[model samples]
Target: MDFQRTLLIGGLAIVGYLMILQWDKDYNQVPTTTQQQEQHQTVPSTEDAPQLTQAKQGASDDVPMLDSVADAPTDDTAADKQVVTVTTDTFAVEIDTKGGNIVKASLLKYPVKLPDDNEPNPAPFTLLERSSARTFIAQSGLIGPDGTDSKGKATYQAAQTNYQLNGGETLNVDLSLVDKKGVKVIKRYTFTKGSYEVKVSYVVDNTSSTTWQANLYAQLKRDNTQDPSNSSSSMGMSTYLGAAVRGKEERYVKLPFDEFEEEKFNADVTGGYAAVLQHYFVSAWIPNQEQLNNFYTRKAGSNNIVGFKNQNNPLKLAAGEKGEISATLYLGPKDQKRLAELADGLELTIDYGVLWFVAQPLFWLLTFIHSLIPNWGWSIILLTVMVKAAFYPLSAASYRSMANMRRLSPKLQEMRERYGDDRQKMSQAMMEMYKKEKINPLGGCLPILVQMPVFIALYWVLLESVELRQAPWLGWITDLSVKDPYFILPLIMGASMFVQQLLNPTPPDPMQAKVMKLMPIIFTVFFLFFPAGLVLYWVVNNLLSIAQQWMITRQIEGQAAAKSTK
Candidate 1:
């Protein structure tokens, strides 16, 4: 139970685990299909009508529904209609008049990158967009019996094409559609200052004699286009880019597009929501918490649609009734604080893998440190110091065990050489020597074994935290979430690892010694691709361990010198 040997084996095992993940990432890429997302265009025949992002089919049942441009005018093609633009302090969104749907959204606060200080970063990060090459947008409307969006996306008219929240608390961009019977449904998107949540509500003014009863549907649609937000797609094992929903079975469930072909995700959810998750951002539609919601996933054309509809409790209104039904739409960064406020489990979108329980506390601690330190890089170093301090007792015990083992290494080697191939005699001699020295071989390995999970969980915390994206530590290290551009930190980490290993007793087995010598090089290569924050943690830990081990080894050597003098 030599600690150095165990540590080598454990380190190599970790490298093997990472290799497996890299292999999966290399092979498990969702293949791009020859199928392009059918464009939202108008057609005459129901059979010839183009499939849209919605889950509904035109000829499905007694009520024929056509999804297009959620807009098809009986006379004029609405494709040429203008897109209403709404701007606030936080974001800019474009609403296509044909469907009165949110076709594009860009976060004003987040830029693509801050490459140089010469000029301000010009482009904001665009989350949702609809174009020839991409179709990732949020759509919401009234559907069911007398559904305004059922006939086709009824063309809506806006008072002004551009609306901006200038010195205002809230901005309301309304798209109004009127039926032949004079029923008007105003689809409104309300945005408050400094908020990512949009309250999308349908105001139904039933001017007809018949009652207007229609259910509300809100969904996120996207093509299998590359995730623009994920800068690490090429780095391997990119963060999850798919759909996540709060289901009846699990608090957080991911429904991949490929899974739809095999088995669709269908469930009746209450106080639940569905979201399209990407690298650092998310677009979710949270239906009424009290209403019975039908969550679904389907492959329409080349688009993957994940959404929820109030199917069980349709918005029923008597003739000439004035009523409304609404759902909250969140389109922004996956800010845990904002998301948690919107829904019960929406914050789970941050995704820290299987060790989320451990990762969460680590994040909370890191964030707490950041609040005090004000810089993420410095925060990470302090957090590392704090973590080391917390485990000081265990680490001290392990270091003492290693120091004793180091002191006994010569005699252990003597026993090995004296016994030669006499294995039984060599084992007996080693045990008797260990007992005489009063050193437990298992002492060092077990403490490190207990610390492994915490370190791994912290790795995930550094890898997954969006706050680390584009966050700078110091000169040349602009982003903590991505690999160090110059490979400086990893090299330092490797050097520290070698120094730490030199303080431990060498293995009696030459083959094990050789393998142990290469651990630093192997680990350095692995960390070359890891995010800078994680590498920083490892380097700091190794340096601190070396300081502690060196002192203990020195004390033991001094004691041995005193005994020889006596």
Candidate 2:
């Protein structure tokens, strides 16, 4: 085999990889119709309803205003200013000071929520809103008072314009609601300054003439309206946390539920619910386990109720009695180390799939390699080399098949001359000779076919693995998750394929040869749109394989020459 043929085959492999990549891009493009439907369905039905940024901007003339003032606080210096946000058109928070302590943060995940069970489609602007996924808001003008000697911790309860915490290392913020007579309703949230766990304790003093009963409730407001019926509609809730199939074999990765799923479940409960959407999987904590079976909903312009009701254990906060329901919310990647420290079953959100039995070890080894190299692209290169080395036995056999094909070329050509115009006789003679020589002509094809699945599995592993996203590889290539800006890697990949083709001996069939010749061109075009990281892996693998084959071919030629003399 010559280097050109080796390069050609390698180029084909890159092309093959790119073909899959481009098809995914063309057909599986983002900004789907489902998102648009969800956005459209979110239009306000009444004026009294909380005004969205759109309605306030006069973009929505049909929107009606409520007779009573909306729940949104008008006071710019509201105590929970961190939790309040106005639309770009209707409201804007003017931070008096920068780098201030964030007291009450309510990072709204969606732009708007619909009144009905219909979901809203996503707007391009809405998608852009999520570009800055991390939203943080805090109190301003408190820096001078922060480092004071008196308990420097900022308290959540105080409504003072400026606050200074005690000397304690941790601070607890509260969400207190007082009645007209200045009686506490909902207890304040005592969250540590920089932690997800909040120790919520409340003291409800009933100074009223009669005692009133209330239940402690927690709501995580989200928008789930979109035109789910439209296939083009792209709903945020669905895409944010939805199951996706991977690999050519269609491997499944199930997302966790956070909604009621029973048949008899009320529309109010089942219309829409919540579920945790992780970098990999989703686990939704619903009010009850029964909610899990009602409906697996994922359509835009349709309500997708998330967050189930606590079925197994529902805490009750009685009148004049205080009860606390505390849960540590996790808002980070599906990293195994970080997730392990959270709560029960939280780590399961990172779906490795059934192949995880083998894939996990492989992933760990690659991770170790990555930690040392400090570049995911290099990590993938290292991992591919290791995998190839492990499979060398089979690969060597495959290579030997090519070597044998090269050696038998002259003999096969002579035989064709001898048996000219006698098709049946020539076929019989070739089969007999193949059996006597014990040459496995099919050996090459078998090994290549066997490795194909492994290659595909690895491709999915790299694509879906969030750890590889935004991973760097020295210079020029910043994000492995996205395509390369310059087509250098892919072009090099094409050139390698062209070289591999030149190395491999030509087949007897002219038509087959022509088709093979065109493959590199087809693949080169395909690779133009493939993810840069994927193309990088193929380029490295091909370069290494080309070198390995060159050495092996020379050794085989030397052995054949020695045998021929004897």
Candidate 3:
């Protein structure tokens, strides 16, 4: 086979591989008035239903049951709805007084849409919601022999309906509950100054004659709703939208919603966590790391739940004794460093795929460049240049080989004409000419093959990093992590690719030449929907390649002309 023919087909295969990596994502956008719509849920609720009940009713399967224990009915099934709102520097959360559940939460730092200076402050992105369209909430309670939620939803009383933390290091929101039997329980939610992890604790004051024995359960219940925060949804480039658990053997295990019926996910995990992941954010239950807990995924009524429960022994307290049971809930962006600090393998949520080894270093370099330049777009360009420089020697050798091939193109064409239909003679003449010229037909192809993994790894880094969300570089390129609105970068990249091809020797075969001519156009259209950052990288890389190839080609041609004159 002709080496040029092989190279052209190989290039097409790489493009095909990239298209396969991207899958279509169905985006069912929520109504613009999600805030107003959330005020009244679609769930059929009693005029005076329990406050927590309204938020926990995404589906019938929202709550979990203990082994051999059925939940008993509650006396206040029609209790009035009541919630305590807490506002901090990083969060706006609503806690239901009934179960002390985090019924609604808004990430104060992130907005539902990019802010327009002309418009009022954009509303905070709603991370947890309770409505007919979306049901995602954080629920936790004591559920064992004498658990509050074991006998239906537990109700509590808060001192105030609203709380705020500003210029303070920490804030605490407390809800109190006292049973008729004299057992008092205080559910406290602790928030730090700028942290997304909220500690949900249950302080039990067991004053009853009998011992208080109950296990703590924390879980996230959500529907299979589309990820609204996914800005990387260009041409169906979707991120993971499912549950991920920390495995003893593996760093991360993905539990997709569609796999719920295939089998029940139940495991005894020590010092582990369970979480529901979306495009840029995740809500996780990082249980007490010291205790051995049970991590599970199951359907509650119509809801899919991923959470943890205490194993081995329930919290036991004798009469007149007091104790506490608590777990931390992280609800915010998936910052790698912060997530890694929260729990082991939490940072894996920022998935870089099989080439994480290569992607990790690329991300580090990209971030290091950003730290120096202070602009993600400019930083990306610098990173690309550095990457090109690192491979300069290899690229130079490949360009030299191509230049040599171009110098011999006319001679090979003359031989093809001389042999006419004698294919055997043509092959022998081509081999002798190549050997005489000391040319290795495969030389130019190896360099690109060697660099493919590195480039592919960079693709994932640009797609997965949340730090680049909404970051801008110069005019018209607002968000580096999203597709360009005007598509200027893709056009530039396409043109650069075409120019790079012009620097190479055109294939002698008509069919091969046609495919080579179409490559740039095909890639330009394919990149139209790619993230702006990725396209910027490609455009810069191609421009550099064209300059390098042109210089090498000119030098090689000059030397050939000198030799012919001699």
Choose the strongest candidate by lDDT. Answer: 3
**What's the CA error at residue 527 for candidate 1, in Å?**
1.9
* Tens-digit lDDT track of model 1 for 1-566: 69999999989967875775576468733322222223323222131135442224333111112222222222223445678999999998988887677888989888776655643554677788776656788877767667876665667899998999999899888888788778888988999999999999989898899877888788888888888777543463577889999998788998887786567787888878999988888899998888778887776666787888788788887888899889999988878888888887899998988889988999999999999988899999998898898999899899999998888888888888889989899888888888988989888888998888888888777777778878999998888877776678988999898998889988878899999999998888777767788888888999999998999889989999999999
Cα-based lDDT for every prediction = 0.79, 0.45, 0.81
Question: What's the residue-level lDDT of 431 in candidate 1?
Answer: 84
Better of 1 and 3 by TM-score: 3
| Candidate number that wins on lDDT, 1 or 3 | 3
**Segments of candidate 2 deviating more than 4 angstroms:** 1-173, 178-300, 340-354, 410-427
lDDT per residue as tens, model 2, 250-349: 2232332233222211212321222344333232322222221121222111122222222223333334544443333333235656544543334445
Query: What would the TM-score be for candidate 3 when compared with the true structure?
Result: 0.87
- Candidate 2 has a TM-score of 0.59
Better of 1 and 2 by TM-score: 1
TM-score of decoy 1:
0.84
After superposition, the stretches of candidate 3 with alpha carbons farther than 4 Å from their true spots are 1-60, 66-79, 415-428
lDDT of 3 by residue, 1-566 (tens): 69999999989967764554343322422345455455545564332243465346422233455662223344445356598999999999988776778878999888766766643577888889776557788988888788887766788888899999978899989899888678999999999998999998999999999988988888888888777677455463678888998877776888898786566688887888898988789999998888888888876555677888885658899999999989999999989888898889988888888999999999999999888899999999999999999999999999999999888988978987899989888888888988999998778899988988998898888888888888898898888877776667877898898888888877867799999999998998788778898899899999999999999999999999999999
Question: What are the TM-scores, per candidate, against the unseen true structure?
Answer: 0.84, 0.59, 0.87
